[model samples]
Target chain A: MAVYTEIADEELERFLAGYELGALLSVKGIAEGVENSNYLIVTEAGPHILTLYEKRVDPTDLPFFIGLMEHLAARGLTCPQPVRNRAGEALGVLAGRPAAIVTFLEGMWIRRPRVEHCAQVGEALAQLHLAGEGFAIHRRNALSVDSWRPLFQRSEEGADTVLPELGAAILRELDHLEQNWPRDLPAGVIHADLFPDNVFFLKGHLSGLIDFYFACNDFLAYDVAIGLNAWCFEADGALNITKARALLAGYQRVRPLGADEIAALPLLARGSALRFLLTRLYDWLNVPPGALVAPKDPLEYWRKLRFHQSVDDAGAYGMDL
Target chain B: MAVYTEIADEELERFLAGYELGALLSVKGIAEGVENSNYLIVTEAGPHILTLYEKRVDPTDLPFFIGLMEHLAARGLTCPQPVRNRAGEALGVLAGRPAAIVTFLEGMWIRRPRVEHCAQVGEALAQLHLAGEGFAIHRRNALSVDSWRPLFQRSEEGADTVLPELGAAILRELDHLEQNWPRDLPAGVIHADLFPDNVFFLKGHLSGLIDFYFACNDFLAYDVAIGLNAWCFEADGALNITKARALLAGYQRVRPLGADEIAALPLLARGSALRFLLTRLYDWLNVPPGALVAPKDPLEYWRKLRFHQSVDDAGAYGMDL
Candidate 1:
């Protein structure tokens, strides 16, 4: 729930002049993306999302994100397509920040996703992976296995204060993951952060996936691992194997996972859990004064990591081998 | 930029069952009203604003707010009209809060309002006051002149911490306003908080006025005073008399102000300035830690109040005598 950059009306009118979007009807700051300011702008043409990239987003990587969305949408993937202005540029500057407008997707993300929603998300995820093939740009996952140790090191000193012996536990887990991380797997553009909030559903049907800021070149199965950690966990820290089975089955129906990818599921899940835990831990320990967004609890991911540690193989996730 | 209430997708779907809005398409938390959770919901029927009343708003006043809007829109004012459900009800409960859906107005509020915009706002405000006549449900202005002293008393101890001698100045101004406050002036439904953001403009035309939570029975001239303080003041704390002239002249073109109303303008403007000042001062001094909305600077109103105090008569506000 943020609108960091306030755009003046005249400035916005001037900015919209570059586009053939017609006269601006209304521009409302939407509580959507956390890293960037998003506006659900309505014009004489129709509704579109006007996003102003904040400092957190690397400008160099924006082309990749925008290009990936365009590529995916072009291949019949349900996603927001970047709308090019009359100048034939998809991106522009507004309020002294890099901004772009994308066609508004009509759907709401499910809060309490049911088994069917999970299945739909799985199918959609696989479809996205298939559609992302041969995208011209490549961006490495910044929060992948390699970045965890450096991220954990920054938050290590204060980690124990969050949970008992948490710092020591993370250090041990990081060492194990760094050594055992999968080197060769089916790699593609993965929506690294396919959280439930980023996936929209309408009338019990998967409408689309959004927030491609975290999309990068990574193991396609690693993206599924992130989805499992994000969607398959319950409030009591227990894994819902029924939903997991449904999710895995749905994905296999679209694009079957390789033997190596399936073999690495347990480790990938653990790695995904660690990735979120490290980021959340750093944010929790380094919350600046008067920050708008409260840091999510790192211990939730810690508990998730522990659960993955208990899983000995992909079978534990109810994957049909 | 706040979304205090998190409405579940299932719950929202169930809630929408009562409305013939054609299966809910999308609901996005909008950064609009401060005292309520507002979502820009779009369905087959079209876009509407769904607002959940927060704790700040009194539940008893909900009827007056909704009824007044209905009344005003029926009278041909270009404000948001309350949308009734199948049960012919405008209000309902959503996420344990009183909520209602209103037609979405199409226009953007001016960030830097020009003299023409001020004229439009002035004309529109006068139209609102006239249209609000004969509204059966009457609500007293909660933050009127009578409430200032008590409000100031709450923030008096820390007022000077915001500005040197702010507390003393406020106390003196409160006494002056309370004693000299107009009585027996023409009274009707006044949009007491007619700030620029509440008024929307499109293609150089006044589209509508919104946020009627502050609409109440008060002297219509006092609403003009608020408009003067809000739209006529430049960013640097100086009054733009040319804008003020256009504003007052525009209002007179609709419903001419009586000599008594004109004479009371300066004192009413000072009182209006003090009304906002006291509330802002209280909020500034009493901001809760981790509160999402930052308290507006109280001294901005203090400066406006000081300027109002220097005005001798309505002519000083560029009122044509």
Candidate 2:
């Protein structure tokens, strides 16, 4: 829920002059994205989303995000297609920030995601990974294993303030992940943050995946691991094996996991959980001023990490080896 | 920018079950309204605005607000028409808040409004007042003169902290307003808060007026005065008499202003300015916790009040009285 920058009507008209899309009918700031100022813009042509890239997003990495959308849309993936201006540029400046327009996708994310939703998301994630095969640009995953320790270090001092054993638990997990992090699993462009909110569904079907700011080249299997943690967990922090089996089955139907990938799933799942826990811990400790969102409890990820620690292999996730 | 309540997907589906709007497709929280959780919901039927009334709005006034929109829309005004469910109820409970769906009006509020925009708004407002003539429901303008003293008292102690002479000036103005306030005028339902953002324009024509939460029974001329202050003020706090004249002229074309109404415009304008100034002062002093919007500078209203103070008559607004 943020509109960090506001575009004046005159400025918006001037900006839209470069686009073939018809006159701007409306621009309603969407209380969705936290990393950017987003507006649900309507024009004579159709409804679209106008986003102003904020300081948090690296301008240099924008090309990768935009290009990935274009590539995915071109490959028949259901994602927002960047609407290029008449000058043929999809990205430009608005209100002193990099801005772009994308065609609006019509769907809502399910809060209480059923096992079927997990299965559908798994298929979509596999499809996204497959679709990225021919894309040229690459963005390194910034919150990957290598960055975890440094991120955890920032919150390490007062981490116990959140929970008595939180700091030591994170330190131990970081050490374990550092020593055992898989290096040779299959890699491709992964929507590093495929949270439920980013995945839209319509009429009980997955419509699209959005928010490509975190998309990057990472272990494709790690992406699967991330999805496992995100989609297969209930509110009580318990793993739903039925949803997990459905998710993995749906993924394997598109791109089967190799023996090494299967072997590495548990460790990668733990690493994914630890990665999120560290970042959530940091945000939980130091909420930025004027943050519109409440800090998600870091302990949520801590619980997930503990569950992953108990898992011996992918088979524990209801996968029959 | 506000989404005070988070609606679960399941709850939304169940709520929409009573509506004829077909299956729910998408729900995007709009960062526009300050007093409600508003979502641009789209279903098979089409796009509509779903408003979850926040605590700031009185539940008893829901009937008035919803009824006013329905009445205005039926009178051919291009505003959001409250959509009734199959049960014929326009308002219902969603996420423990009063919620309603209204037909989505397509138009954008001009940021830098021109004279033509002001003129169009003037005509539209006059039409709204006339259309609201037979409205059975009555909502007292809670921010009317009788309430200003109490509102000011809440912020009076810290008012001068915002400006050097702000506190004393407001008290002085309040005394003047309460003494000289017009006793008898053409009273009707007025869109008391006809600010620029509430009026929408498309292709340089006023398409609709919105946000009827502030609409109430008041001196019809006061509505004109509010619009004059809102739409005729330049960014530098200077009054644009040409715009003001166009606005008044536009209104006069629909329903001629009586001698008393014409004479009362200046004082009403001053009162309108003060009303907003006091509320803004209160909000400026105390922005709610986790507020998504920055408190607008109360001094802006103070400057407007000072400008209104200097005006001697309606002629100062370019009307040849």
Candidate 3:
């Protein structure tokens, strides 16, 4: 976990008292999160990821994650299947922290993401959308544009740093976009973060997708827009043509994009970019110093926000917003 | 708050019974955080950022935050000063969540960050480090290189999408960095996320630095490396020479870089990038459907990791890692 807390091996063993993840080989604490305490756990049952609920995540909502995994695994989605205990619950307490044991996924997150990987991501996302059908639990994409502004308001004090007119500009964009947001498209659960690191590759072929914490059902095409903004944008803040094309074309192969989805692409992509920008902006202003959690570079999202703001139409994203 | 329970404003009013935020004018829900349910509150005390602590932060820790703010504010740090209750407590309860109000900072976050902005940021960070003395509190920069693997392991089960080799590479870098990390230079609390957005600028001058959540007492020089990886990097993943010169020169004017710190620059930058990559990578994999939070672009961090990995010397950052 990103925060500091003492967790001795013996203290942890009690938390795993009834589970069968095999013998605990190691409980190395994970350090790159602001929301949870994670440990790399090696066990006889095999390698598993152990997570202790950190700030922001509700223990009540733990079931959603646990149940989602169970459901996804049953549907053939290659994800970490949560291990159930003797009482049949997949979650438990470890060292007084809400905890769970998740099977380890395998693959290397490529440092140099290639154009083809973008396409592979696009294809995989489409397949995931189709596969997510019939899941028992339900959650709407909580971050659709209607919800974007309120996040900006959280950091209202710092709105003027980059834009002399940030508050007004954001308000105007929200009003305009709200009036123009699209409706009616194939909707289902989506792998929102299709960055190469989230898509596994074993020998250059897609292996298993992991990290379902931000998955949600929304405009299926919005997921596509999110991917485009993420996978197609180059480090210099320029959109890569080959990468964009491959990603779109690959996704289209699995789940054909309708004209409306294409027409809404740019607006949705801007919204997606703003979504990240706003969150990063808030985080940049709020995280306490000397706290264990790492704060993301708020400027990167600012960079992406600038790129999105420059776009006046959907065509910029290789789609028709 | 991204996943707040439906508690009405009036229902949450009682929790505000104790604290004095100076006549709360309005409460607007922020739907994009993993930790706290925040409200943009306008009050007689002025616009304030109101937060209802959700999961990660404890009610007991409120004093630390309150004291932390008071200490920093006392030192001339331009950030939100925590509002306290009649009993000298800066925290209380709101809607069943631990809550408090912080004065809103004013200044817009720049959307399109410029090279000059980097210089301002460098200067501001140095100012922060210099200002963060003992201040009657002690909290470590828990996110030092030692914390990386533990966090990666928590998401390791299926994180092969971005783990294994990345973790190992980071481990090796950590070893090299640990052996050579600067220790004798300046040491103090740092605004680690001194990205352009986190620093408030009134006109061309940096009026304040916001977001001390990741603020910690660490090797002050490492903070500079974090800035280099962030503000000084070009959009193309290469070091932007002008920004690098401006930022470093600006910081040097304030704190003056030491030879050991300069020599350790590459590894420090690599550590910073890897730290972010691991977190972004984990979040990328864990997004669940319908969660309002947008997963950050792991590719961005991945690219950063690659860039840092490619740097063989501290001079790559125009310093001597």
CA deviation > 4 Å runs, candidate 1: none
Considering the two chains of model 3, state its CAPRI-style docking category: incorrect
Q: What is the TM-score of each candidate against the true structure?
A: 0.98, 0.95, 0.49
Please provide, for model 1 over A257-318, each residue's C-alpha lDDT reduced to its tens digit, 9 standing for 90 to 100. Answer: 99999999999999999999999998889876656666788889999999999998899889
Q: For candidate 2, lDDT tens digit of each residue in B148-185?
A: 99999999899878888788888899999999999899
Q: Across residues A191-278, which tens digit of lDDT does each residue of candidate 2 receive? A: 9899999999998999999999999999999999999999999999999999999999999999999999999999999999998898
Clashing pairs in 2: none
RMSD of each: 1.4, 2.0, 26.7
**Least accurate stretch of 10 residues (summed lDDT) in model 3 chain B?**
B24-33
- DockQ (CA atoms), all models: 0.74, 0.66, 0.01
Compare candidates 2 and 3 on lDDT and give the better one. Answer: 2
lDDT of every predicted structure (CA atoms): 0.90, 0.90, 0.68
- Which residue pairs collide in model 1, if any? none
For candidate 1, give fnat to 2 decimals. 0.78
Interface RMSD of each: 1.3, 1.7, 21.4
Model 1, CA-based lDDT: 0.90
lDDT, residue A104, candidate 3: 69
